[model samples]
Target: MGWIGETVDSIKSLQIRQVLTQTVSLGMIVTSALIIWKALMCITGSESPVVVVLSGSMEPGFKRGDILFLHMSTDPIRAGEIVVFNVDGREIPIVHRVIKVHERQDTGEVDVLTKGDNNYGDDRLLYAQGQLWLQRHHIMGRAVGFLPYVGWVTIIMTEKPIIKYILIGALGLLVVTSKE
Candidate 1:
């Protein structure tokens, strides 16, 4: 009876140690991801250094489900350059081509007009009410590089949240069950 009780206590301690190890491992992984994201933000000088294209507005150049790498630089913006911007009332950001740029001589600020490649008209209608042009502050970053069709995973997860939850659960299960 005494030996059996000793065995039970040893087993409980081993289980607790395994759970703690898994929890620490999960924390380390999350911390590493955050560090990498902060490093990218510092390197690119953009709040969002990577964005997934969610629309087909810029078809033939940037299709849906594409992954775009953004870079915010000090160079002057020019016509025909692709940019991602946010509107005053809208939550999602838009990606479009710069059709026109009007630099004000008095303030040195520029009024930027943008249009989607597949759209018939400029983006004035899409802008906030009473606003005709996008300012420098509205611009998030310019498209520097892209990966074709790489953003489909993100799109699928966003469109179907169930899959996202299932994926997270599976990862947690694996981490907890992993022997090594």
Candidate 2:
């Protein structure tokens, strides 16, 4: 009876220790993710250093579910360079190639016209009413690199909220109940 009581107490203590260990590990994982995201933002000088392609407009070069790495540079934008920009009333940013660049001599401000690689006409029709060109302020970043198809996970999570919640719950359970 004495030996059994001692063993039960030890098992309870071990369970508590395991739960504490797993909690710390989970905190570390979340902290590391935030640190890495902030580091990328700093290095690229863009609020969003990465973006998922949602449209096939830039097809052949970048398909839907592709991830594009973005970089903001002080250098002037020119025709033929791919860029991401936000429209005046739209919530989503657009990725397209610069078709024309008009630089002001007095202020050095640039006005840009962009067109999707797969589209027939330029993006003027897509812009806000009466807006002819994208200004420097509207530009977010230039495409620096890409990873194909990895963004599908993000799209899936967004499209199916239930699956996302299930995955999160599973991860939490695994972390808490993990042996090592």
The candidate 2 region of ten consecutive residues with least summed lDDT is 10-19
- Evaluate model 1: give its lDDT: 0.92
Clashing pairs in 1: none
User: How do the residues 1-180 of candidate 2 rate in per-residue lDDT, one tens digit apiece?
Assistant: 999999778657776778789989999999999999999999999999999999999989999999999999899999999999999999999999999999999999999999999999999999999999999999999998989999999999999999999999999988876789
Task: Give the clash count for model 2.
Answer: 0
TM-score per candidate, in order?
0.89, 0.91
* Winner by TM-score: 2
Against the reference, the lDDT scores of all candidates come to: 0.92, 0.95
lDDT of 1 at 1: 100
Q: Which digits, one per residue and each the tens of the lDDT, describe model 1 over residues 1-180?
A: 999999778657667778788889999998999999999999999999999998888998889999999999977778999999999999999999999999988987989999999999999999999899899999999999999998999999999999999999999888877867
